[model samples]
Target: MTTLLLAAKAAVAVLLLASGGAKLADLAGFAGTVRLFAPARSSGWVVAAVRHAAVMIAAAELMVGAVSLCWPALTWVNLAVLTLTCGFVIAAGLGYARHRGRPCHCFGALTKRGFGLSSLLRAAVVLAAAIASCMPVRPAPQLHFTLVFHLLLLAGAVLMAAAAAAAAKALLTQPDSAGTVA
Candidate 1:
């Protein structure tokens, strides 16, 4: 069970890192998704606000995920992840209901999945993983990571984020089936 919990935690952390990095790679695309949820406001400030919000959301995910992965002992980080997962679930449901076939850009150009049942299902799975990660592991002392280990973990997290960003950027620049940039 402890091993399962640890795996769950790592899975969600990696997901967050990848999603955040991908979003950062295509902020304009992610901003469009954010604009969808906005209160139908059409103003310069509103556009700027949505862009800022998208950037902040991506940054928060990256920071929280990196911290959680590098220091699993911080139990509060589990709850933080759970909270973020809850938001994702809500967004997924809302996006599915309101924007059926619209591309969510949830993973930037790395994925072409639109707002639909698949999106909802994926969000649910992520939520489940996050919940499982919050479960208490027995004899926590059995895993005592040193400062060096934590630093190494952090480095790996950064690398994962950078790779995801690079992949998304490449996908964004590539021509689509219609001979248009994605």
Candidate 2:
């Protein structure tokens, strides 16, 4: 049970870290997606606000994932993960209902998968993992991390973020089906 719980925790943490990093790689693209759900027009002050919101959302995901990985014993982190997952669910549903077949950019350019049932299913799985990780387990030996270990974990998180950004940027630079650079 403990092992399962730990795996769930790790899965969600990595998921968030990768997602946040990818979004950061293409802030303008993400803001375009955000505009689909916003009531505000896509001009002037509203555009700037939307871009900032995109940054905050991506930063929140990165911070939450990094903190969760560095301090797994922190029970409150579970709640934070759960909250993010819930937002994912909402996004998936709205994307499907109002913007079906549109690229979600959920993983930036890592995928071109549009919003659909599969997106909802993916969100559901993440939500389930978040919930499972939050389940209480029998008292087990508490795992402790040294300062060096924590630093290593943080380093890994940074690498994951950088990798996602690189991959997304590479994909964006590739030629499209029409053979024109995108």
Candidate 3:
């Protein structure tokens, strides 16, 4: 049961970190998606401010997940991560409903390959998983596994962000430059 709990914690951290990192990597795209749902479409400055806020919130999520999972001190991070997941649920639902058949910029290109209800449901479940991690944990002497898991997770996140940037650059460049991006 203790091992199960640890696995759950690790999975939740991975899911949250991935989603948050994806959102943070594409601020303008996420903001544009938010603007579609938001009422502040007319005001240019309002849209920009709202977009930045969304990015900041996503940044908070990425940081919280990393710290809570990788760092030794638990430090109320589980609570913060749970809160972040709940917020993401709200955003995903709202984004889904508002789009009404449009693509979501939530997961960026990652989800574009395949869309599923399970994805959204999994995010909701992750909220519970995060809170569970906050509960009284069993005495597990294997701290090294935890450390290794988190480091690998963090490294994967960095690579994913880099991949997103590369994809975005490729998409933005014109056809004139085949191998070379303008």
Top of the candidates by TM-score: 1
- Highest-scoring model, lDDT: 1
Distance from true location, Cα of 80 in model 3, Å: 0.9
Kindly list the per-residue Cα lDDT of model 2 for residues 67-130, writing each as its tens digit: 8887777789889999999999999999999988777878877777878999999999999999
Least accurate 10 contiguous residues by lDDT in model 3: 172-181
Q: Residues 98-160, candidate 1, lDDT per residue (tens digit)?
A: 977787888888987778899999999999999999888788874567999999999999999
lDDT score of residue 60 within candidate 3: 79
TM-score of each: 0.94, 0.90, 0.72
RMSD of each: 3.1, 3.5, 6.7
* Candidate 2 residue pairs in backbone clash: none
Better of 1 and 2 by lDDT: 1
Give residue 134's error in model 3 in angstroms: 2.0
Per-residue lDDT over 31-58 for candidate 3, one digit per residue giving the tens place of the 0 to 100 score = 7666666674377777777788778866
TM-score of 3: 0.72
